[model samples]
Target chain A: MTTASRATRNATSRPGGRSARVRDQVLEAVQAELADTGYDGLTIDGVAARSGVHRTTIYRRWKTVAGLLVDLLEAGVDDTWAPADTGSLEADLVALNREVREALSGDSSVTLAVIAASFRTPEAAEALTRFWDDRYERSAVVVERAITRGEVPGDTAAARVVMAATSPLYHQLVLRRSRMSRAEADQYARDSAAAAIAGLLRH
Target chain B: MTTASRATRNATSRPGGRSARVRDQVLEAVQAELADTGYDGLTIDGVAARSGVHRTTIYRRWKTVAGLLVDLLEAGVDDTWAPADTGSLEADLVALNREVREALSGDSSVTLAVIAASFRTPEAAEALTRFWDDRYERSAVVVERAITRGEVPGDTAAARVVMAATSPLYHQLVLRRSRMSRAEADQYARDSAAAAIAGLLRH
Candidate 1:
C-alpha cells in the first residue's frame, strides 16, 4: 500500500488497537475546532483538551496544525453526489448544481477554513487540490455520460462544460461573499449547461 | 482629497519626482516579476532592486508585500467596458462577455497570479473584490439598458448575470492547469451570454 493508503488504514482501523478511540475522538475534536475557530485558530492542545487524548498522541499522528486539518478535510470530504441521468444535459447539470449549492450553503465551516488555509501552505494546497479534484472528477463523469448519450456533442469538452456549470459557486463563495442558494445555483447550472451544449452542437 | 487620492495625485503629478518615479517603477517591477516568476516567487527586495528604488520608499508607500501587490493589482484593474446599446439583451451580453474574455485572455499571467495571491492575503482579496465589483457595475448598466429597451425583465438580477458571464474565466484560470486561449474564451463568452440571456427571458 502507498504511504497515504497506509495512513488512511491507520486512521480508520480499530481492531485490537488501543489508540483507535483516541484517533476518532481527536478527529472529532479537530472538526469541532475548525467549525468554532476556523483554520488560523485551531491548535493541538485545544484538540487534546477537547478530545481527552494525550497531546503526544495527537502530535505523533499529525505534525502540525495544518497536518491535522488536512487529515480532517480528507476525512470529511464527501463523495460527489451521483449525477442524475436525466436524459437531458440541462437536467443533469441542474441536479449537479443543486448538490454543489447545498454543500456550499451547508455549515461546512471546517471545509471552508481548510480551503482558505490551503492558500497559505503548499501541503495544505496539495491536500485541498486533491479534495477539489475528486469532486471535479465525479462531475466530469456526469458530463461525459451526457456526451455519450448525445445530449451534448461527442466532441464537447467535458472539462469546459463542468467548469461552466460550477464556476459561479466558487465565484460567489470566494469573491462575492455570498452563499449560493439552491434555486440560483440550479438555474446557473442548467443555463450554463444548455449554452455549452448548444455551442458544442453548433461547432 | 483622501489620503489615497492625495497619494495618487502626488505620484502622478511630477515627471521625475522621487515619489512619483519610485511608485511607477515599483508598480512596473511588480508586474514584470509577476509575469516572470508567479506570485510565490515575488519579493519586495527583488522589486526594489529591479525598479532601482530604495527599499524604504516602497515600505513608506505600502506597508507590506501584500500591500504592494494590492496597489499593483488595483492599478491594473480596468473600469467597465462600454455597455452595448444594441437594443437587445442578448447582443449587449455578448458584447460584454467579449470584452471580459479579451481582457482575461490577454496577459493572463499577471491576473492569475493576483487571483492566487488574493486567496493568500486579505488586502489582495479586497483588491480582487473591488476589481470584480467594477466589472459588475459596468455590466449592471448594460442590463439596465436592456431592461429599458424591453429586452429583459426590469427585475432581472443584473449582478448574477454579470457573474455568470465571468465565472468561466475564473474557473479556467485557477481550477484548470491551462491557459485559456482567446478563441476558446470568445466561444465561451458568447455561449454563456446566450444561455444567461435565454434564462433571463424565460423568467
Candidate 2:
C-alpha cells in the first residue's frame, strides 16, 4: 500500500473524530517532512500546508513546533509489550530484542529526527523519556518472569537488564555515525540478550 | 588563580607563538559562550568579539562553529583511565565507575556543550564517535585486565562492558527531561557497576 493509504488506515484505526483526524494528518505530514528535510528544516507552516489542516487547528493541539513533533512521536512510534511465556528466558529475550531492532530500523529517520530536535526542546526530551520508559516497562516484565521461573535471581532489577539489552542498539544509532543494517541489528540483539541473561543468572 | 593567569601559564608551557595564543583565547571565549548561551546560541563572531581575536584567526584553526566546538571538547575531556588490577572484577568496576562519575560532574562545559551540539551537526557526530572510542579504549584496559586475571570470562567483549558502564549517563543527558545531579550519577554508577560485575561472574 502507498504511504498515504497506510497513514489513513492508521488514523482510522484510532477512535477519534474530526479533530483527531486533523491531528493525525498533521503528524503524518510532519513525519514525511522529517524524512525529506530533516529536523533542522522542518517547519510548522509546511506541516499545516501539507496536512490540509488550518494553522489554527495545529496551533491549538500543539502550541510549539517541538510540542507538535513530540506528539507525533508519541502517536507514531510503536511500543513493544512484554514477551509472552516462551518457556525460556533466552527465547523471550531474543524475541524482545528482535522487536526493538525492527522498531528502530524500520522508522530510523523519524527516530533520528526526533533525537536531533530533542537537543533544543524540553517537550522532545519528555517524549524521548516516555519512549524509553515504555520500552523499559515492557522488557522488565520479561525479566520479572525469568526471576519467577527461577532462571534469574529473585532480587534482580528488571530495568537494568532491559537497559543492558537495548543500549548497544541506541549507541549504534546515535554515536556510531553509521546506519544500522538488519544483520548488524540482529547481531547486537543476540549478543545483548546473551549478556543480559548471563548477568541475571549470576545474580 | 585567575583565569588569565592560568591562560598565561598554559601559553608559557607551550612552545607556540602569538598566533597559538590567539587561537587559545578564541577557543576559551567560545567555551565561555557555550556556558553562558548554550550550544544553540553560540556564534563565531561572538567568540572573536569576546576574545578580542580576529575572526580570521578563529577560522584559521577551526573551520566552523561545530569544528571549533568539537576541538574544544577534545581538548577539555581527559581520558579517565584505570587499570583493572584489583583482583576482583567488582572492585575494579566500582573504581572505574567512580572515575567516570567524577569526570562527568567536573567543570567541563565544553564537552557537555559539544555533546548537545552533536544532536544537530554531522561534524559533531564524527567528533562524538572519536571521543567515545577513546573512552572505550581506556575502559577496555580495565576489562582486558580483568579477563587476564580470571575475574571475568576470557571471551567477554571489552567494548560491550565499557559501553554498558557509560551508556546510562549519556541516556540521561540526551533523553531524560530531568537534570542529572551528583547523587543520581553516583547511584547510577554503583548500580551499573554492580550489574555489570554480576553479569561478568555469570559468564
Candidate 3:
C-alpha cells in the first residue's frame, strides 16, 4: 500500500500499534535510501538513522540489507492492490500500463532500485520473482473481465496479455534504459489491446 | 561479433597486431568473470589474473572494471552482425527473437552479465543504451524488408515494431526474472508480428 493509505489505516486502527508503524517507517526509510543512493549505497545503519529506529532492533529483526528488501516486497504483495477496471479490455490495459510507466519513470525510482537489487542479491531475486508472480496474477483480472464482456476469447492467456501490455514500458525503462513520451507509452498498451481484440493472443 | 569471428578476422587481416589481441583476451576474461560472479565480484585484479594481461597494462588501458565493460559493449557495437532474412515479417521476427532468447538463456550469458552490469555502473548503463540503440537500428532491416515485400504498411514505425517484437523476451528474463518454454517465448514474437500486420503499431 502507499504510505498515505497505510498511515490512514494506522490512524483508524490503533490496535495495529507500534509494531505496524515501525515496520512502515523502516520500509519507507529503506525505499528512500535506495532511491537516493541506489543498491550499493544501501546500508543497515543508513536505514536506522533515517527511520529513527534503533540499530540493535533493526539488526535483531531484519538481520541484513537483503532481509529488509525481501520484507518490502512481501509487504507490497500482501497489500490490497489490484488493476483498475474500465469496462473494456483496451481501457483496462491502458490503465495498467500507465501505472507501470509512472512507477518506473522519474529520477531514482524505487521500483528500479529493488529491481537492480535483485540483480545483486540472490534473496532479493527470489523475492522479486515472487513479487512479479503475484503482480501478474493480480493483473490477470483485466483479461478475466474482458472475457466476461466478450471482448476477448475465453481461453485467452491472461498473464501473457498482461505481460504484453506492460513489457514495452519496462523494456524502454529498464532493458533499453531510455525514456519515452507518455503518448508513446500509451501506444504500447493500445497495440496489446488491439492484438487481443484481433484474437492474436491465445493460450 | 563472436570470439570465433573476431579471431578469424584478426587471422586474415593480421593488421590488428598484438594490441588488438590483448584487447580481445582482456575483454573475454571480463565477460567470463562477470558471468560467473556477477557485477559485485567484478574487479580489475580478477580480470588481470584471469586474462594474464598484467594489472599494470589493465590499469593503463581500461582503468576500472566499468571501463572494461564499456569497451566490451563498444566492440559489440562495432561488429558487423545483422538479423537474418526469412522473407516473411513473422518469420524474420521469429528469427530475431530466437537470437535474443538464445543470447539470454544460458547460465553464464555475457548478454545478461552486461545487462545486469548496467544497473550497477553509470558508464555501463550509458554503453548499454548505445548498444541497444545500435541494435534496434540494425534490426530495423527486418521491418524495411517487410515494408518492401508488402507485409507491413508503409510508414510503420521500425524501432517501435522491433521493440514490440523483442521487448517481451527482455521482460520475461530481466524484469520478471523467470524462465519460459520455447513455445511461450515464440508466442511473444508472433503477437508483435500480428500487431504490426494489423496496422495497430503504426506511428
Candidate 4:
C-alpha cells in the first residue's frame, strides 16, 4: 500500500498535464459509478468506459477498484482547504463540525459513498486513513494558534482536540444514522473546546 | 419498519414457546450467514436452509433478510448485561468502551456485520437505531450514579458522554481501520469523562 501511495505521490509531480488530466477523468467516473450504483457496481471496465480511458491503463495503474478510490482520496487532500481563523477555538470547531455535517448530508453524498466503499475494501480504508491523517495535521493548526493566543495549554494534543470536535458529527450521522440538527452538531465542537480549555485534552 | 418492529415485539410475548424457538433458530442462521459471507451473501432462502425453519414461516413473519437481522439485534438486548459497578464515571466508561472494543475486535464480529447491514438497508438502520437507544438507556445509569456521587454536574448529557467515550473507538477502528491499542482505546473513555467532569457535555 505504501508503494502504491508513493506512486500516487510521484504522479503529483506531473500536475495539470496529460497524466493528471487522465487521473481526473477516471476518478470523476469512479464517483459517478459509486453515486449511481455504489461499490457493488463499480468495476474497472465500467470506470474505463465511462472515463473514455483504456481499461489497460486502469489495470496497469489502479489494478483494482480500490486503486481508483485510493487516488480519489489522494485528490481530496486539497492544499487550499483549511479551517477558518475564528479567533476562538470553540467557534472554529463549530465551523469545522458544520463543514463535516455538510459533507455527510444529502442523498448522494460523495463522502458518504466513499465511507461506504471503505467499509467494503481494505485499500479504500487505508486511503481514508491517510486522508484523515492529513486532515488532522491540517486542522491541528487551529489549536496551535489557540495555544499562541493563550486559549489552551501548550501541552494539549491538537489532534485529539480535532477528533473530539469532529467525531460526534460522524457518530450521529454515520454510526447512529440519526437526522442530527445543526445545533446538536455544533454542541460537540463546544464540548471539545471546553474540554481543551479545561486542560483535559493534555498530552 | 415500525410495523415490522411492532410485530417483532408481539412475537416476544410468548417467551420460550414455539415462536421463540423458531426466532432463535432463524436469527442464529442469520448471524452465521453474515459472519461467513457479509450482507451481500445473505438470503432468506439461505437462512431457511441453515435454520431448518420452513421457508414459508420465514416469509410470513420475517419477510426479508433485514427482518431476521432486526430480530437478531433485539435478541442482543440482554437483561443480564450491565456495566460493572466500578463506582466512578471514568472507570465505568472505560469498562463500557472496552466492551465495545471487544465486540468490534474479532475477525467475525457480529456487531460489525449488523452495522454493515444497517448501511445497506433502511430497516436495518431503524433496527440498529432502536438497538442503540436501548443500550444508551441502559448505559445512562452510570452517568446518573455519577451525578449522585457529585463526580460531574447534575445536568450532564449522559448519552452524549457515552457517545464521546465510544465514538473515537469506532472512528479509529471502523472508519480509519487503524489497529488501536487497548491503552489508546481506554484514553477516549478518559477523554469523554474529563469533558463531562469539566461540565462541558451539559444538556
Question: How does candidate 1 score on lDDT?
Answer: 0.65
Stretches of candidate 2 off by over 4 Å are: A1-11, A76-87, A106-108, A179-203, B1-14, B49-52, B73-92, B102-108, B178-203
Task: State the lDDT of candidate 1 residue by residue for B1-203, as single tens digits.
Answer: 00111112333444766665777778778877876777888888888889898888878888788988778656544312346677666566666655555444444356667766876787888877776666567567766776677656566677766666667765555543336676666566555456545544244
Docking tier of model 3: it is: medium
lDDT for model 2 comes to: 0.61
Error of 2 at B155 (Å): 3.3
lDDT-sorted candidate list, best first: 3, 4, 1, 2
> TM-score rank, highest first?
3, 4, 2, 1
Query: Higher-lDDT candidate among 1 and 4?
Result: 4
Per-residue error for A137 in candidate 1, Å, reads 2.8
Better of 2 and 4 by DockQ: 4
How much is the lDDT of residue A179 in candidate 1? 64
| B5-51: candidate 2 lDDT, tens digit per residue | 12233443566788667757876787688767778889889998899
A123-175 per-residue lDDT for model 2 (tens digits): 78677777666656656787777777877677766665665556666666664
Q: For candidate 1, lDDT tens digit of each residue in A23-95?
A: 6677778777777777777899999999898899888889899888677557534322346678778887887
Top-DockQ structure, candidate number: 3
What's the TM for chain B in candidate 1?
A: 0.72
Any runs in candidate 4 off by more than 4 Å, and if so which?
Answer: A1-15, A32-65, A78-80, B1-14, B40-63, B77-81
TM-scores for every candidate against the unseen true structure: 0.69, 0.78, 0.91, 0.83
lDDT of model 1 at position A101: 61
lDDT for residue A117 in candidate 1, whole number 0-100? 72
lDDT of 2 at B149: 73
Ten contiguous residues minimizing lDDT sum, candidate 3 chain B: B1-10
